[model samples]
Every structure is written in C-alpha cells, then in structure tokens.
Target: MVDLRLERVCEEASKLFISKGYARTQINYIANAAGISVGSIYTLFTSKKAIFDFVLKCIIDGNYMGNNMALPIKESDFASLDGEILNVCKELSENFEKHILDGDDSYDFKQMISDVFDIISRYGVAFLIFQSNGSDSGVLYAYYVQFRKLFCENVEKYVYNFMEKGEIRRCEFPEHHARLILETLSWWGMHVKYDAFETNTGISQDVSKNVAMDALLHAYTI
Candidate 1:
C-alpha cells in the first residue's frame, strides 16, 4: 500500500516537474497532487532531487505514463529479418500517421514537430541528469549507453528496409544515411518544442512522406 502511494507520488511529481519545471516544484506541490503527506514522500525519496531523478529516469527509460514511447518490436511470428524490419517500420509509420493526422485538432505537421520537441525537451532533463551523473554511477551510465546503441540499431534497420523496398535511393554508405535520418529526428526532438520553425504543415503528412520518398528514390533508387 505504501509502495503504491510512493509510485503515485513519483508520477504526480513527474507531471508537476514537466508542467512547472523542476526547481520551482515543491514538496507541498507533489504531496497535494499525489494526495499523500510530505513526510511520506521523504520516506520513499531522500530529497526532491531524488524524486526528480527517479522521475527523469523513468521518463527516459520508456515508462512515461502519458507517452507511448515503446520501441518497435518484431513479432514472434516474423522469423525473417526483412519481415521484422517491415513490421517495425509499419508500426512506426502508423504511429506517426496517427499523430500527423488523427491527433488533437492542432496536430498538423508543424504541431507534430512541436510534439517531438516537447518529448525531447521533457526527456532531456533525464539525459542531462545521466550525463552529469555518469561518472558516479557506472550501472546507470551503462544502461543509458545501451539504450542509445539500440536507438541507432533501430534507425539502421528502418533505413535498410527503405532501401530494400526501393522506397529510398541507395546510398553507398547506408550507415551514414541511417545516421542522417536519426539525427534529423533527434534535432526535431531537441529543438522543436521551444523553437517552432516554419515546417511544411500545409502539405499532408502522406504527401510530405511521399515527397521525402520521391527525393530519396530519385537520389538512390536504381
């Protein structure tokens, strides 16, 4: 029972941090939002910083309650690498499509970029924390490194699938192409929330993706 309250406190604390920023968020704020006592929070977390650290770690580690941040997984039924990659891309594409199309009224392409940026800005707190604390905690640093490496692997798989399907122009350096796409997305993630740029929201996502596909096809598809 205490553990559950602690968990709720952590969740409320995270939302408050994202909504209000960390330094401004107080123990009373968390206690009120979580419907728990300030002393109880102290029992589970040594300090507000500790609670923030846990919240940041949880958000970046793919446990953020409001964000569907799961990594693309290959189905057990798909035995082949190509099949797995296709399934993963399809899933990713569907997610992006829904956001780009069926999201809240303002969720156009520009808003999509904004959303990506929002996710990055929120997650960056944890990443920054990890970077600062890396030397002190070998295990935590190693875990973050592992996730970063997996992110790269997933990018490569997606790029390879595009090449295989003739959706993109083939690059002599496929890895470089993969890196470019990943970096582009990361850039959007990092800067889009606070920096709203003039994106092509006038175009539909399908048309936008088609344009990207056409550009790649013209550049690499033989």
Candidate 2:
C-alpha cells in the first residue's frame, strides 16, 4: 500500500505543476504544500522530474489513490511504462463505453452527450496538463496522443453503432463526426474552465452541454 504522506505529496505537486507550469514549480513549494520535509520528498522521488512523471501518470490513469505514486518506476522500465499506458487506455475506453447510446431517440443521444461531457469534466485538469505546450515532457505528451486516438476510435464506434440503430443519420464521414464531438466536448468541458486566456463564457456546465447536445443531435439525427 502507498503511504498517505507520499500520496499527499503527489497530489500537492500535481496541483502546483498545473498552476505554475512544470518548469516554475519547485520541490520546496511542493514540500510546503504537502506539509512534508524536502528530505522526505526525496525519499519518495529521486528528483523533481521523477515526481512530475509520477504525478502525470497518476493523472492520466485517474489513480487518485496514489497507488502508482507510491513506488516510483525506474526510467529504464519500458515494459512497465507500456503497461501503465495500456491501463490508461483501458480506463478511458471504459469511460467512453459508459456513454455509448443504446436507444434510438434524441433523449438517449443527449444523455450520452451529457455523460461524455461529465467524463471530460472529471478529467479536465489532466487534459489541461496534457495540452500544455510549455512542458518538456515528451513522454507524457506521447501517451496523451495515444489516449486521444483510443478515445476517438471508441467514439467512432459509438457513432457507427448509433447510425446502425437508426438513431443518427448515416454519414459518409463518421470519423469526422467523432472528431467534432470530441473537440466540442474538450473545448466546452475543459478549455473554457482551464485555458490561460479569457475563454470562459459564464455558462453553466448544464447549459453548455445542453447546447452542444442540441447542435449535434440536430446535425446528425434522422
């Protein structure tokens, strides 16, 4: 089991990294936020980079329990890293599956869209970190790209399933529709809340999700 103090360190470090950017965030800041000593932090993580990597992995896999953060994986452990990436993909696929529509009606489509938005909202901070170009973490970015592809593929499958069910109109470009849906959700559920610029429209999550659902349903419904 992971130590509670270690978990607190990772959580505080992640928040600081997100707020201050990776380069500007310091180990001391994390120590202060986590109420731990700098030496204690080093006992858990070899360096700042290691802590960042651990936080990134935890965020991507939604492992808030800090199970992954407890034991730091070695940098040379490519196989272990691949396994972690696969776990992230599996977690994302399960979330997408939960939102797949099962009925042939606008209400079903709307609920699916809302659920998708909620999923994105739950992972909003992680997505923001993934999109940050200021960070030099190429490995994290690559894993994020893989996760995005997996998510879009599952969304495409849902689109095809809905089309076959006669819930949505047949389209020649299901991939395009899936991309549009993902982009819409990402912007409304994530960017609007976390982007550096003034992108907030003062719209509630329900209003934004409802508007997006209405637009999508109108465009694709029979």
Candidate 3:
C-alpha cells in the first residue's frame, strides 16, 4: 500500500516537474496536482525535495535502462554482420529520437546522471539492509537493479561492438563515445530547435545527426 501511494505521488509530481520547472513547482502545486492535500504529501515525503528526488530517480531508471539501452547481437545469432549492425543502429536511433531527443529535458543532463547514481546506491543498500529479512522492498529493489544492469551492460556492449566494427569512429574512450552521443543529441535537439543557446547558430535535426555520424565515420575509417 505504501509503495502504491509512493508510485502515485511520484507519477503526479513527475508530471508537474516536467511541465513546470523544479524551482517553480511547490509542494501545494504537487498536492493539488495529485488530488491530495498538502498534509497528505508530507505523510509520504518529508519535503518537496524528497518528492522531486524520488520522481527524478524514477524518470532516470525508466529512460536510461528501461528504454534507451541497446543490447548486442552475437555473430552466430545474426546471419550477416552488416545486417545486424544496421538493425542495431536503427533500433538505437529510434529510441534516441523518441526518448532523449523528443523534448526539453525536465532536469539538466548532469542532474539526471547524478540521480541515476543515487538510485543505484539506494538499491545496493536496500539489499544489505534487508538481507534474510524477506522484506518486499529488498526483493523489488534487487529485481529492479538487475533489470537495469542488464540494459546498461547491453547498451555499453553495443557501443563497443559498433566501434570495434568501424561502424563508428574510435572514440578516445568507448564510454566517452556512448556518453557523448547521448549528450550531443539531447543538447543539439533541444537548444538548436529552440534557439535557446547563447550562440545564434542552430542546426536541423537531420543535419545534426548527419554531421555527428559523418564525423564519426571519417575519424574511424582512416
């Protein structure tokens, strides 16, 4: 029952935080949005920050591992390497377009990264604290962490494989390539589309993607 209430509150608060920036979203606003009283929220969360943190973690867990992460295709599993590579790229491109590039980020990328780390830590501690206690919290946390780890590891492997195959340029580091791909896409899509950056220069999404793709190919091929 507590978990259900937490999920509901977090979902509603997530909406509010995204629609209205975090600074402007007050506790009363969340309570109203959730169709609950201000006091009711306090029962579940000590403060509005607590609510925001939980909601932010949920968003990161959903976006990073749940959807955007890509897995590897084994050589034996695929009839042809070329076909498998293209398939992976297509899937990854679609996910990038939909989740990370679709809209203005509710929080900055750095904050999202930090929140993801926090959630991982919480999951780890939950296990240690509840081992042999058979608490449902421990079970749920462990399962969620494992599920997320699978996606994260798969995505990292996909990035490394693509680099190794010369599909993408050799990055200074493999992880750097993966992180930059995401960060560049998010910043380019949002700021370029909105002209929100200090610089007046803006690029279309197609051009932006092509530039990055071409630069990568050029760097890797020679």
Question: For every candidate structure, what is the RMSD over all alpha carbons to the true structure, in angstroms?
Answer: 13.1, 5.7, 16.7
Candidate 1 residues lying further than 4 Å off, grouped into runs, are 1-45, 57-124, 191-222
Off by over 4 Å in 3: 57-222
**Candidate 1 residues 1-222, lDDT tens each?**
125665687667755665566667788899889998877666656667666555644554454334332222112212242333334334544554453244244433333333333434455544444445566434555655655565566556555655665655667888987676555545444323322365323544344444444444345445
lDDT of 3 by residue, 1-222 (tens): 134456567666655554455566788898887778887777767666556445534443443223321122122322232333334334533543343344433433233333333333333222222232223222333544454444355445555655555555566777765565444444444334332335336555566555544554444443
Top candidate, metric TM-score: 2
Best model per lDDT: 2
lDDT of 2 by residue, 80-100 (tens): 554675576677677566554
- The per-residue C-alpha lDDT of model 3 at residue 123 equals 35
Inter-residue clash pairs, candidate 3: none
Order by TM-score, highest first: 2, 1, 3
* Backbone clashes counted, model 1: 4
> Residue 169 lDDT in model 2?
90
Better of 2 and 3 by lDDT: 2
Cα displacement (angstroms), candidate 1, residue 169, comes to: 1.5
